[model samples]
Target: MEKNFTIASLEFCLSQLKRADESVVRKAITSGDGLSESSDDVGQKLSEAHKNAVKQCLTNADKLATLHNQIDACDKVFERLQNMLCSFQNNLGTIGEDMKQLQVQSLDIHQELENRQKVRNELSQFVDDIVVPQPMITTIMDADPNERGFIEALHELHHKINLISSRGNGEAVAVNDTIPILENLKYKAIEKVREWLLLKIYQFRKPLSNYQIFQHQLLKCRFFYEFVLNHEPAIARELQDEYIDTISKMFFTYFKAYASRLFKLTMKDAASKEDSVGAIDTAKSSGISGFFAAKPQVRNRATVFSIGQRNGVLQSDFLGALIVPHAAAQNNQSFQFETLFRSLQLAFVDHYSHEYLFITDFFLVSENEALEIHSKAMARAVSVLLKCCEEQIVVNWDAISLHLCICLCDKFQQLLIEREVPDVNGYWETMSNILWTRFDQVMTNHNDSVRMIDLKKLQNQGALDARPHFIVRRYAELTSAHLTIAKSNGKEIGPKVGALLESSEDAIEQLLTRMSTMQTSHKNKHVFLINNYDLILGVIDDNESKQSRIYAIVHELEQKSIDDFVEVVLDPHIGFLIKFVTECEGLINQGHTQLLVRYNDKISTVITTFNQKWKQSIDAIHSEVMNLFTNFRLGTSILQTIFTKFVQYVQRFSKIIAHEVFSSNSACSEMINVHQIMLEIKKYKPVY
Candidate 1:
């Protein structure tokens, strides 16, 4: 019962005691015989235990009350927390609704901003595209055309007008309203440009005015023409017509005066009828007395095709000198026909090339329009120059000079092409036509001159002699010159050249026949014919292309003449020898051995006569040939041919002498042999 066993242990002891029966306790007490330490001690222990048990129960009850009070306070605290959590959940729900509403408001605000931005952009574009600034209008109305601001302003106005015209609609009423203002400004600008351009163009009409400078100035503002053309085509047409008229008239007057003054400086001694190839001076008397008459002493005349002396006419320095009045006067010189033609053409080419470029650049026209404009501008000047050329070509009898003029025209045309000048209007083509026409006419004139030659007049004038006729030499030179020109120009002059050659050949044949009539004998006639033909051949021998048709023809004629002359001259030297050989061969061929035997007696005689006289015959023939033939080579050639014929004749006769029919005569076998004859002919040949 001490400190180790408190009220709860006491209660445990009392509960155990109570659980014991009272009868057991009484019995145990009454049966003292079995009882140990008495019932009194047991009672006291139970009593103390019971008091302790009760005190513990009262303390346990107070502790239970305190635990119950603490449990109720926790219940109150948990209830208050639960109410606060409910309030928080309700606030959270409210906030979720508020956030959804704010999100919607923000999206609406952003959508509003995007719509406002689109509207602002559309407004800005409309304003920029349709607005025409006051500064631009002022520039178009009053600004100087030379100022850069004016062109810029005009460009802006044109753009705005184009935009309005292209996009005019119900929504673009503002843009359409600007059309009148832009049109007024456009007209004003065009008027200003037109006045300025017309002033510059009018200045070209002034004498000694620097039109090139003005043209250069106009080129800077060439865009003005394009603008006017686009806005008002009628006004553009007027300007173009005015420019063409003014410039064309100026060129006409300028070229007309220049050509007139230039024509005076042409050489007065140009080729004439007298210088013609077939010209004959009928006034002169024939000085010849016989067929072998000496050729008249001819003056030293310039060769027909020798144009080197006339090259000064094509010199650039000479062209420049002739253009200047002072220089031309100081030189006091006359130019050839080609020089005059070249100068005038060169001037035209320069003017044309410059004017063509200027018109195309300044007008901004198409190529066809530019060409038309150029043709109109140059029409008057071209007509005058071409007329002058035609008249000069008609009168001038120098075909060589005319040919040179044609070459000059071709060269100038090439130069124009190189300068990129278009020939759509046929200016060069027309010029070439005129030149070729005149050239062919001149050629025809020459041909006609040859065809119309008077043989009687030529013979009476002593123009025909041992030498080649002047006409033949001139014809050869002209043919050669024409061939050279054809080759150089890459043109086909064959038909014309052939006609000329045929005419000349006919004339030469006629002339030779007439001269042959004057010969006293057949041999002399052949000699005269041979001499003239040989001379003609020699004249054309220097031609590089020996394949020329004329060369072949003349060569053939010469050969025929030589053959005739050789037969005529050689027949006398060995006529009987050839006849004897022929007669014996005929008798042998006819199977007449007896007749061949009879001819053998005449064979030695014929051989002896030929041997004794062949040298004298050769010497006489040589002397005659040297005296008659003008070409010494031809004379020697003839002599050699005669000597060869003489040898052949003697060899034939010697062979006839050695024939079996004449073998009975020992003297025939011992006669001079062909070897001895060759030895004798060797002495006559020239050493060279």
Candidate 2:
């Protein structure tokens, strides 16, 4: 019945329900017996009441049906919900067990964290204890902290600090917390080392006052530098400067006292040596040879503190010994030594204006008023100084040589140049000679070992490529300056240049001739003479190109030299033959017909003698001549020219005596005689 509750079926059910209610109302009205006043009214009221009761009963039944249907739907929904809740209950039990396990794990983690914290705290304490094993104050307070023990303690401290740092980012927070403490320890350790070093220096006792304390202080400084400062060069430099300052004060005091003592001792030794020399002179007056001979004397190192002490304490003196020669030595040690000595040199100049240091004396000419009066001592001193500057190591060449040159020139000006009756010619000549000598030495031997300065090397390495030519140009400048000065003074420079050229030519001629004579080769001797003579001629020809009077003289010299060489070499052979022909012509002109017959024999002998000598000379230089002249045609041309002259001379003689001296009718006449000599000459068959 309840399944018929669709919209159409419910409308039909509601229609039937309304009809039943109307039927019950009508029955109730019809059956009603008692009516209160009016029967119809009473019946109508009773009918209404019956209809109400019936409607109430019908409404209750409909409501009961709807409630029963709703209760059954609710029962099915509750049954499905109970099945779903059963799975949830099982899951909840499992979740509750998991929650219990999580609580137990939380407790275990909390306990482990506490244990780790305890371990970390213990480690922190241990690190703190190990980072500084010995109290720094104790070490600082000690009079002399054992260096080994102190270093070990510091090593341990640094090691522990490094270990803590090595814990890395995990312990970065911890390490940062401990950094200040570690830095404080390092600071205290460095301070202690400094204090200890100072104490050792203060306690240093040296009876013999010398540079020995400086060496001791250096050792301590190195210790402070490497051990305390480590790689902190800034701190090390500060300490080093302080130490050097203290030592410099000490050194100056000792140096002044030592200098004073050395001066007195040197004066005493000089006096005693003079007395000893006088005694030796008296003892050795045996002969002139003995008197002139040099005496061999032993030098006492202690007595001699002045110059020439090349092997004594003065050689490795305290001031000089302080210098250490190396790349870095220039900065600290060498700088200090230079500063000290520079001050000393200045002070010496102030105190001893007249007295010169040995090096200064060697380089600078002394102010001698007597040199104008022809004093021998001043000349000897000048010679000695020149020799010393050249040979001794006491003078620095680069620094002192320039000063020495200026001093020499100034002294020359004073004594010779500025004189009232100065020998201007002699002065200019001497100065010019000096310039020439200097130039010649350098030009000839600029590459020799004695030249310590290598301009070629300098040019190769220097920034400017022209550095090597500077010295060469400097010589030219000096020469020009001297020449100009001489010209201004109206001195006779022409004679000097002429003399130099003559001397040079003489030297060249002597050398070439000597070389020619010394040539032992039998063949090509003339060729060898030609090669040597030509080489010299080429040099003189080059010199001639320079438009100077000197070169002009050399050009004249060159011509004379060549003419002389050619005469010496070539004349002996052909000159004699030419002379023979000329003499024969002279005889013909004088009407010596008898002599013409004998002339063939005499001329033949002369030609034979000249040919032998000429052949010998040619043999001497044959190989050299062949090597020297690369052009065979040129050599042939030269030979042709020489022999053609001889041929022409012979031909001229033939023409002169042809018709007069010989005829076909004459038996054993001069023409037949001359023909025999000509045949002998033709046998030579000169190739050129």
Candidate 3:
């Protein structure tokens, strides 16, 4: 029943209750029966209301049945919807699981694609870096040697070889498989380059071949040498040795022939025993008193030392253009000894420089190894040059010519250094030692000759001249030449210079001694000493700093000679005045004023004698000085010096007479004044 009570049944019950109330109210109003007879009346009214209420209940029952049917229909529909929702939830869970699986699979596919692409790229790169193509093999095997294609192929082949040799890729089977093939190709390439280089090297042996042009050609293919050296060092060594041997022998043979022919053109009479510095001879054949009394018109040929005349020889380039013509002409024409020596040295230097550059440029070698190679290649050639130089040095007795040869070596060595040639110092130094040793021997011979000179014979052979002796003049010129060479070369004067000077001094001393024995007068001995000493000093004046030792000695000797000359000339004329003044000064210095006073008459008489003889004394001194010194200027210089000393002595004597001996102005009146004496001396000053 509660289930049947729908909204329609509850509304029907409410309508029945409202209708009963309405009927009761109508009955009370229409009958006006106040309920005074209400017991029976009310019972009948209640029975009628009950009948209406029953009918309305039956109608409500029908509506409530219909509403219950609709409710049952809604309940069935809701249950079906709930079952459908549960099935859908289960289906959605399965779909979500499938979607998650699909997402994971998609991610795996993306990763696999990326890894495959990476592997493909790596494989492509590996093949590109490792594979050798057929074109490369063909090019290496059969291309022209001079073509760019062969070099490119060779580079590619070497790259593959390096990959096989490298630590990281050496164990790869693919890389290992190609090694044997690459090795054969490399060997074939090496042989091709080796044959080419050997052919070029052999061309140097051809006569009249231009080696510098050949060297330039080799330099263009220098990479071939590097290739051979890297692949097979033994083959490279063999090539280098072959080049050294071929070049050495070629240079040796060429230079030997060249030098032999060149030496024949040298002057046979370039130097003689008469050209020696210590060879002293008189000028008697020329009707002169001293050896150098008459200066030769051709001064270059006459002098014992005259390097200035051979400046062309010193500065010669000795080029093949100049040498070859002279060698081929084979005329009777000849050069000086120094000219020959310089030509040989310069030619050798030019060849050595070229050879050094070639060895270093074309060979793949260490610096020391390159030097060793160069030395070996030039060894025989160097021996030829040294041997030629040795013969020249040993056979030649001309000291100046030998010295010039030494200078040539120095100059050539410096030229090589300037040209950036490799070290060939051993050769130059060896040649220099040979030259200097021979020079030393020649100089020693000269010194010994001077020391062992026959003074008596020399005296008997020649008359004494006012000029320097010929031997002294020759010694002076030789010493001057030595100093000039030393100074120009920026070197110190050697010990031999000192020995030469000592020997020269001995010679001059002997000369003066001979002159003293020949002359009876003290004046002639002083004159001879002065002339020789002055000549030496004048000749070496340009090299004073380098020849300070010799310069100082000669200077001192010259001053002593002048002093002796002045004493001998002046003593006879004014000895009394000088002695008197000297004695009076001494007495005055000793507090002997009384002794000086007693000598007043003597002083007056001395003044009278000086006043009478001063002019004659100066004139006589001038005549004697002019007679003694061959050089007029030298005579004037000595005369001026004598006058200066005489004036000074006169000044002292006049002061002594005035202050010490003569007490009165009248007594001082007779004294000679210094100005008057200087005025008289000024008449004799030299013009030039």
Candidate 4:
């Protein structure tokens, strides 16, 4: 078959070569004819050769067909032999795989028998060794046996029982016979172990355990129950309950002992009987003093935990862990931490009240001392409030702020009423300044937060909610407290609020200066200053009572500040625009022959300059003011004011030109075309 295929391939190649050689010979003959300029005889010879080649191809085709049929017969036999060989090889591979599988089966059977025998031996050994040591039982019988020694022996027996049962190889049935014996030993040891555990609990010392005896011992006791009485559920429950009850007693004992110690360390004797009685009398007489008074409380015996000498007791990790399992298993919510928190709060108020009273009494000896105390107290209070806000504590921030402000007011007023305060104006001024500083801080912080917010994102979502403003809740509280103090003292907040207003003016001026320094192509500084002044005015306006004297003073101050700011900062730009228009009007009044053309060329430059400066200012003012204020609306009144004067100048110039035109020759004057001049002037009109 191989030889036949080679011969057929050679024959096909030879036929193709012969055709290629004939084609080359014909091409050569045509080239020769063209070169020689041959006639019809050469063409006849070429036609004859083509006819002969066609006949030869027909003969070759018939021969190739015969050869192809013979090669096909040999190929069939070759293919049959190849198929037979493949089948034989496949059969051999199948037989080899069967033998390998049979070997594996035989090995598995042998391993199974061996494993069975080994398991039987292990089971026999487990059955034989399934008994506790006799000495451990004897030790339980002994009067003063080693407690730890007995525990170790029982642990060994428990370990062995677990090891054997966990095999699940039918050796667990062997332990059925050992259960009664183990139970009997456990029953005998229970009383002794309970007594020993109770003794250990009672003997625990606070200094050594750090009040965590119960937590430290719980794990050991749990392990003991799990190992010793694991098979006896009822007995385990009874023992655990007893252990917990004993723990409860120990907990109380430790708590009480610690409480007593703390009370001894903290308690102080009354320095004078008269002072003590006077303090009580003052608390009762003065409404403000009661807030600072230390009061007694009757304990609630029903509460499992109560506020006492230290907060650490209630916050102990052991107590929390101990209560978790109980809380989880309870049918009802019996635990109420809020009650404990409340108790602690009341007790804390009392404790701190006394401490605060004592400290203030020392400072109250002199006016200077009192002022010092007042400064330090207010500073600390503001610091703590800011810290609480930063930490995001869940507290009534507004209420606490109000209470603190009220307390400050009361403290100052009481001192004044008693005629003990020195430098009355100094006291109130210092307070007003402190409060203003705090207000400024709050506003600054709020502004920073507002700046970070995604304003564009919020606007796009249509969730602007009127553009939320920075909250100044404490500002209201502090102001109200200030007014209340002022009213009680029969004083006015003219100087106090006047000081704050000055501070506000300085801050606005600084901001405007900064915007100018940046040299941005925006004109919003004036607007920003205006809006900030307006916001400050709004605060006063929001709380102002027309009938009140302080409100009147504040209103007057705010109005004056706004008017002054506008004149000093904003009027210059408006005046410049006015001057430029006045100069243009003067040129128009002269009415030269080519006056309008010259004016258009000159004023175009002026208008460009004016718009650049004006637009820059406007942009700066708008951007900064919007950042400071919420839902701000601006008017084109400034633009209108600027343009109105220019409109007057243009109208007056037009009227003069019209009069001149009408007075001249009617035919020649019509050709002047004044409307073109008006259109050129209109090109310089301000879009703003």
| Number of the predicted model whose TM-score against the real structure is largest | 3
Please provide, for model 3 over 251-325, each residue's C-alpha lDDT reduced to its tens digit, 9 standing for 90 to 100: 999888878877777665665545655555543445444455554233233434655655445443433334663
lDDT of 2 at 642: 43
Error of 2 at 454 (Å): 34
Which is superior by lDDT, 3 or 4? 3
User: What TM-score, over all chains together, does every model reach?
Assistant: 0.68, 0.28, 0.75, 0.28
Clashing pairs in 1: none
List per-prediction Cα lDDT, in the order shown: 0.74, 0.43, 0.76, 0.43
**Could you tell me how far off, in angstroms, the CA of residue 33 lies in candidate 1 after the best superposition?**
72
Candidate 4 at 525: error in angstroms? 19
Report the C-alpha lDDT of model 1 over 398-466, residue by residue, as the tens digit.
777777676666677677788999853666677777777876776666666766777677767776556
The residue-by-residue lDDT of candidate 2 on 560-609, one tens digit each, is 54344344434555666567677777887798877776564454455456
Tell me the deviation in Å of residue 150 in model 3. 3.0
Q: After superposing candidate 4, which stretches have Cα over 4 Å from the reference?
A: 1-120, 143-147, 159-180, 200-209, 217-222, 242-564, 568-688
Ranking by lDDT: 3, 1, 4, 2
Which window of 10 residues has the lowest lDDT sum in candidate 1?
313-322
